[model samples]
Target: MDQYVEILHWNTQHGRKLDAAIAWLRKRAKAAGRMPAALMLNELQPGQGEHVGGELGLLHYPAPVDDGLDPADSRRRNLNAIFIDPDGPLVPDPEWVANWTGPWMPPATLPVNLRNPDGTLSSRQLYLACEHACYWHPGYRETTARFYTVLGKDGRLVHVDGDFNAWTVGRAPLTLANVADRAFAQNRSVLCGTALVADDIADRLMTAGGFVYVHGHAAEYLGIEGADAPTTDHGPDKERQLIPEEDQPERGLSAIDRTYTTAELIPAVIDANVITDPDVDALADHKPRYTRYGYPDLVAITNLPVELVHH
Candidate 1:
């Protein structure tokens, strides 16, 4: 089945102002008999009560409002109240395929294409290209202003930081395919896992899920170490060290190739695992696990594509 997300309003006001807007939309939505399915706010994490939105600073969608945790919680609001038949009117007619012929379609073919009643060829490639230019465009600042209410949660856009303590060797491999697959296979239930446990992977997954990635620290693209970079080793005297690209084991490629910032990475999600340069092998060989040790909700089994998930 195909899904649609409606941003009810996109107000730019941050903090309490955004909260008030959300409250207003919920009341109207309820009155209109359109219950929300999932919310895609600009804040980063889920939380309880109004304060949670205030706390996150609105860089990304705040965490889902837990009904059990706060039945009265209004923050976890959704706007995609209208559901359409995945095969008809909503999708273009040219994209529709008969059931017998649909199976032969490529994985990249969209569900909408298989059943669109509009008859226009809804090219998946075109969809992605448009989406990239619109949502993931270079230096695009996402906001809930046009689609959702502008309650008080507004702040800076959040990004997931890939730079962990270099000595944090015990960390698991990162991928979005693993988490999305599990979420889909497991019936979209929230899998229990800590923020620190598969931290890098989860951040990426959340971004795929349409939330802002809030990497608290700065990230260098391509894993290149800049001058006066801090040593990632453990123990005392682990001071900042200037290292060459070839000599820096932590960095896998040339500094010129370095462009791995969240700003760059989110849009280039498809390229995350592809071995463009011959030198980088770690990402090429790694197959992400569902639950490494105790961590659950690992996203990728192998380097899988996570760009533009259709949940």
Candidate 2:
């Protein structure tokens, strides 16, 4: 039995090189009364343009020895032999397997509208809801905001919320009070009996005007506590002084400073009624203390009754 076979530099323009090669090998195997364990077809000239040819290969192994098995069943038994045969020297490398298998078929396109019959929310709307929740706060070294998506009965994305925390400079022990105080200092004003941080988020959502609030404890929602104090970089005062002042919101400001700026714009977030407690239990049931990637963290307290059409 030949352990290996090679078909080198065959021109593809001569037509169906693989079929021709296989046919030639089958005739050789029939003449020899045994099949080659592996076949290596190298430098095949798939002639079309100015480009050169590529390589192609194939491998097959004989089935396990069994006196009871009929000789006619040998090919069928050996169909996957190359991959499983321990004694076979020719192993199917990933590239060789992939080439043999050909390219994967593309997945079918999903329906354009992935909304429930009630038409309350579309798939796109649900995705945006998650994004809005995550994007509300900008990333900072001292603060971390992590959001999670909530699915409805239909397994579509429906709601999202986050676990947010920020470290602050303070003498008090790391209590919720300290965190709330820091949050308050950051956004300077309270609205509708909620903390300044909560008010800021509420305001942004209200102005956009689509999502309905079921229940939100703005204090707890925007609360931060028990975080380590931010370390000060003790660079030279002269070098620090040389840094010019810039109006960019993310630059040269503490979390508190940014929150205070949001407070100044509190009037923009009108309609405090937009923040309501319709299904408190649902909110509590869905809200999560922590979430891993791809899981819902919060309750479906918020609903978007209409789809947004972007211009």
Candidate 3:
């Protein structure tokens, strides 16, 4: 039967956000109508094991070594979630205890394709993915996003960055959603259609959520465009004018174009049917946030790049 999966994503590194995370999850459950039948907690440890043993109850023959201790404790550092069930023990997947984290798709759960009404949060599973191995890496960021995206099934996934230490995810999901999710899918009773935790390079952390909004940090594609656009990580894709092959350009000196700034971006969103580069408007805030966090970033956007596309 198609059920609902309420997600609560939070970084367990500093682990101080435990209380807040729990509250958010409880709210998610309340909105979903019923608590999850099973919870899938990612990045438990040891090759990101899919472990089922968490703060909540269980079914069938339980597994050993329940690291449900308060990960908030410095010595324990075991970030776990609360699993609740009264019927019987929620049998752990064979691989559940094979490692630290439990199987992403609980034993009886199916993969989320999000192709129909049955695809979305219908899994009735609570998935809590937290922290990288031990350090912070872009690989972790991308994979975590991808995994959550899968859980979201076609863009139904809701990415909540418990912590944005290295500026993990922000306005990035907006584009991903456009590509993976439905136009304006609202499944859960609570929360928006989607939410991507965001932040800027200069500032701390800010929450980013919404259908067209994806946030981790604009740093990946923020200011510093122009002739130098191609020098950044996303340079190859940044909006830029390519020098024709006929123009036999200089050796080391290559071709170039400019990115779009919010000033020239949002107005375009108001009228245009398609945006070649939506990244610019994804983080578009009416009140530019020079500080890097908060709703001010919705429009103000202290720093807007040039030549972004949305379509």
Candidate 4:
């Protein structure tokens, strides 16, 4: 998606290639009688160019994203949310913005938005941020941020971006040392800590329903499979009822594995929201370690109905 969007942004054709690709995608989905776009888009160059999202009938962040800075400026990196589809909420986050060297610039950071035009908190969720700019960089290592979720007036928290404390969060040690945790520890740098920070943020910005519908992958890691099959109860199971057995897997997980700077984020997001532990209940209790998060059950993605289960 980033590649396609990038082409749309920089290519002389602009908007043309992305439109073509979206057309192809919609065509395929229509032919199969499946949802056309379960999309999560990011790195979307902020602007109203073509508004492909609107054309495809996807819900968007609907806030002004321009930070009023040069596109080359790092502070304005995520000022705009390119796209936000419940199914495709995940976006690719290139640690190396444009300077993609293994480590070209240390402190590779940017800021995020905290409010909307109506003054309602603009942050729909936390996966949209990283620790304050003080933490990113070309030097990938394993230390967490002093302010894990965000950095504001009092330096209360540290996250990808935000200017104020939209809400309050407690301070606690997150030495879980999970997979991404270990990688950052070994390398002395890891974005996985962002998970903990985002976990905390999602607690405030989201509800159980937000988690229920957010089944899309970080990038194109669509959570489609018999295990992850969309569990819509009433309407119709497009992937199953309309599509054939052979084509079902395609609707499930794509052969393209390395979801890149993305795939890791999906599970990270799950870890933030759901209780992966195969014991206890999600809707009944929160993951003991996390507060104000999780659900009654952590069943396969396909097991739940396609309705929003608001918290």
lDDT of each: 0.23, 0.23, 0.26, 0.26
Best TM-score goes to which candidate? 4
Which portions of model 4 miss their true places by more than 4 Å?
1-16, 32-38, 48-50, 62-66, 71-136, 139-311
lDDT of 3 by residue, 1-311 (tens): 22222222222323333344334445645685544443323223321222332332233221223355554532143333323233211222234431234321111222111112322222222122332221223333334334433433322322222222222222112222222223211110112246522212211111212212122123223331231212112223422322223332232221111111112122222110111233322221110011111212222221233232332
lDDT for each residue of candidate 4 in 277-302, tens digit (9 for 90 to 100): 43322111111111111111111121
Q: 1 or 4: which has the higher TM-score?
A: 4
Model 3 RMSD in Å is 19.6
Question: What's model 2's TM-score?
Answer: 0.19
Give the Å shift of residue 254 in candidate 1.
17
Question: What TM-score do all the candidates reach, one by one?
Answer: 0.19, 0.19, 0.27, 0.28
The Cα error of candidate 1 at residue 307, in Å, is: 20
Worst 10 residues of 1 by lDDT: 289-298
Candidate 1 residue-wise lDDT, 158-207, digit = tens? 22211111111122222223342343222212233632222222233333
Better of 1 and 3 by TM-score: 3
